[model samples]
Target: MTLVRDIREDDAQDWRRLWAGYNDFYEASVPTEVTEYTWRRLLDPTSSLIGRIAEIDARVVGFSVSVLHDSSWTSSPICYLEDLFVDPSLRSGGVGRALIQDLVDLGRARGWSRLYWHTQANNQRARRLYDAFVEADDFVRYRLTL
Candidate 1:
């Protein structure tokens, strides 16, 4: 069974390994400083961001990051599942599902109006799991990189 728990100060080393795997899967080279900043943000009590890690047999195998913000459509805040990643070697062992399910439970506890996330259209593996949970809406995302 996978244990899903909040990120801790001592989790940096293991979390970095999973973080690197996530970046590798996306073919992006994020700088170490950015990761350090993100780690700090995740631990900041005032920050809206939340992070959770999945471990099996005491080894970290996956992680999820999320945020809650006010929604225009409802008074309750909406949750954005910013990132989800599991070690490729352990992909099919329910780590990802456990991480997401934990986030969903957390979001509901916090009174979030909705919980959502975005991913590359080509990420078929992830899409398959997501598809089993919710129907895709007819919405497209656009962005301008600063």
Candidate 2:
């Protein structure tokens, strides 16, 4: 059986391990400072960023980070699933689906107008699952780093 729960301070070891894997999957080099700050933000009750962990057989196997933001087009907030990752060994075992669905349920209960996320174009494995649950849009995303 699998359990999805909010992240706790004691989850550092597990979270760092899974988070490192997640960063590697995206070929991202996340600095330690950023990771520490993110950890603090996730645990801060007033922060809009939240995190959850998925455990199976008492071992943490995956995690997700989401942010709630106000939307100009609607009164309800928008939920953006900023990050999602599962252990490579645990793929296709319903962990990913469970994490996403948990957030979907949360969004529904919180009156969020939308729950969305973005993944690398080549992340076919995750895209497949996301495609199944959410509609695809033709919008293109561009970012400018300062």
Candidate 3:
């Protein structure tokens, strides 16, 4: 059974391992400074960033990081599920789905206006899991690094 819970201070090492795997999967080379900053923000009580851990039999198997933000389109806050990763060996074993469901349940309980996320078009495995929750919407995302 998978148990989903908030990230604790002692989870830093495991979280870092999973975080590196996540970056590798996306071919992202996030600098060390930024990673440390993100870690600090997640642990800051005043920050909107949140982190969650997924464990099975006391071993950390996956993790999710998100942020709550105000939206111009709604009165309540919205949650953007920024990062989610499971051990590659554990894919399709329900860990990912459980993480997402935990967020959905959290959003509802917190009265969030919406919960959303995006993934690469070619990620069919992830798409299949995501589609089980909701269909992909007709929106194109544009990013500009400044």
Candidate 4:
């Protein structure tokens, strides 16, 4: 059975491996220094970032990061799933689903009004899994680099 829990300081190596896999999946590169900074932030109590790791047989195989923010449209807070990644070898083993379900539970416990995430339009596998739980919105996203 797969288990999901909040990320701990001792799971640094496992977190790094998952982080690298996440970046590789998107064909993106992140500097080691930046990754270290992010890792520290995730573990910092003063930081808003919250992370959870999925483990099976004591081995971490996936992770998800979420952030809570106050929404202008709603008085309650919103939980935004910023990142989620599962090891390719462990796909379809319910790890991802467990992580997401955990996130949903967390949101509910915290009185969050909404929990949402986005992925590449062409990510068919992720989309398939996501569609099972929620419908895609009609809006398009645009980004402007500073």
lDDT of each: 0.89, 0.92, 0.96, 0.91
Backbone clash tally (model 3): 0
Candidate 3 vs. true structure, TM-score: 0.98
What lDDT tens digits, residue by residue, belong to model 3 across residues 1-146?
Answer: 99999998899999999999999999999999999999998889889998999999999999999999999999999999999999998999999999999999999999999999999999999999999999999999999999
Q: Where is model 1 more than 4 Å wrong at Cα?
A: none
Better of 2 and 4 by lDDT: 2
Model 1, position 20, has a per-residue lDDT of 92
Query: Distance (Å) between predicted and true CA of 145, model 3?
Result: 0.5
Give the clash count for each candidate.
0, 0, 0, 0
Winner by TM-score: 3
Write the residue-wise lDDT of candidate 1 on 3-47 in tens digits: 999999889999989899899989999998999999999888889
- The regions of model 4 sitting more than 4 angstroms off are none
Evaluate model 1: give its TM-score: 0.96
Best by lDDT: 3
Instruction: Rank by lDDT, highest first.
Output: 3, 2, 4, 1
TM-score for all models, in order of appearance: 0.96, 0.97, 0.98, 0.96
Runs with alpha carbons beyond 4 Å of true place in candidate 2: none
Give the range where candidate 3 is weakest over 10 consecutive residues by summed lDDT: 38-47
The CA lDDT at 54 in model 1 is: 95
